[model samples]
Target: MFLTNTLIVLATVAGMEAFAWLAHKYVMHGWGWGWHASHHAPRSGWFEANDLYALVFAALAIVLIALGTSGRWPLQWIGAGMTLYGALYFVAHDGLVHQRWPWRWVPRSGYLKRLYQAHRLHHAVHGREGCVSFGFLWAPSPTRLRAQLQAAQAQRRAQPRQAPPQRPPQADTRGR
Candidate 1:
């Protein structure tokens, strides 16, 4: 039973990454841009409107855990996995990549560098469209991401020119 629960937790974590990639690309970058747009803009306070998505996911995990404790099988483990993913996302995405916190250790090499560079490439685009590297925990190679970005930029340039959308105030911290 313990092994089964562990497997469930691990599988859920992996599944969440795939789910997150889909949701980040379609929902967040698509119709949910109303909330997610705040993430791209320079944050004025300690929080952005995008943080609400995390709250929603956290609420789901809480509900799953409550239901599992009430005798529903496996949900507790699933919730545990979700909670773990959320914590990792907070640390890697919010803390390390975006530098939303005061801890300022930049990764000079290895997977950390790839993760950082991939995310930064994601933000290289000005608006919602043409962004790359939607996943948080798992990222593609930085070289591949840059090539994709370049292709996207070239495609956009090839299209008929229109007045650009009203862009938000870009933060100066993108290079870091």
Candidate 2:
């Protein structure tokens, strides 16, 4: 029973990547930008409004553990899964990509580099719109991402240049 529960929890944790991708694209970069925008903008302090989301998720895990411990449900395993996923997210998203922590060991041409490149592409867009690669665990090839960014840059350049409006030469009053 314990092993079964562990597997179930692990599956849920893995499945969370899909949920996370949707939430990041629709919620975090959407309406939730009110808080999440702090992440994209230059930092002013150690903490950010974006950190609130992590705190909220942590609180939820605590709640699940509390219930599971009380024998209310089999939520303990689920809670554990969430905790572990959070730790992994911190290491991958924060430590490896953002350099939030001091652990330094830059990867060269492998899954780690791919993940780093994908996330960098996600941030290529200055704002929330036009960003891609929302899934942290499942990243597209870095070559593809680079091509996409370059294509976008080219498209921007292709847009018609707007010439300044010429002043409708001085009216007839001047001629009169």
Candidate 3:
């Protein structure tokens, strides 16, 4: 039972990375931008509007935990996994990367460096549309992220802009 619960927690944590990537790419960047836009801009106070997402996820975890405590199996573990993921996200995304916390140590090398670089590249775009590196815990190589960003920018540039409709010339009916 212990091992099974532990495995569930581990799997859930891993699964969250993939889920977060998809949500970050589609929801956060798409229709949900009204809330997520705060993250892209300079934060005015200690909290940004984007923090609502954390609250939503935290509420979900709380509910799952409550259900589990009420007798449902595995839910507690899943909730624990989510809580753990949130903590990790806080440390990596908010603390290490964004310097939201007092500790401002930049990663000198290794996976931390890659993670740092990938997220930085994500913000390389001006708006929400062209960003890359959506995942929080997992990040691709910096080179690959850079190439993808460049390709997306080039694609945008290659597309022709539509000209405004022109008014057709009318006959001189007033003279008649």
In terms of lDDT, which candidate is stronger, 1 or 2? 1
TM-score of 3: 0.92
lDDT of 2 by residue, 1-176 (tens): 87898896897689777778888999999999999898888877677898898898889888998898899667877787778878888888878987777577667888998998899889888988778788877799978888888888788899999999998866677555
Q: Write the per-residue lDDT of candidate 3 for residues 1-176, one digit (tens) a residue.
A: 99999999999999999999999999999999999999999888799989999999999999999999999988999999999999999999999999999668999999999999999999889778889899998989999998999899899999999899998998899876
Candidate 1: the clashing residue pairs are none
The residue-by-residue lDDT of candidate 1 on 67-106, one tens digit each, is 9999998899999999989999999999999999987988
CA lDDT of each prediction against the hidden true structure: 0.94, 0.83, 0.94
Per-candidate clashes come to 0, 0, 0
For model 1, the local distance difference test gives 0.94
Q: How far is candidate 1 from the true structure (C-alpha RMSD, Å)?
A: 10.9
RMSD of each: 10.9, 4.9, 3.0
Model 3 residue runs over 4 Å out of place are 164-176
Better of 2 and 3 by lDDT: 3
Model 3 residue 101 lDDT? Answer: 90
For residue 164, what is the lDDT in candidate 3? Answer: 97
Model 2 weakest lDDT span, ten residues long: 167-176
**How would you order the candidates by TM-score, starting with the best?**
3, 1, 2
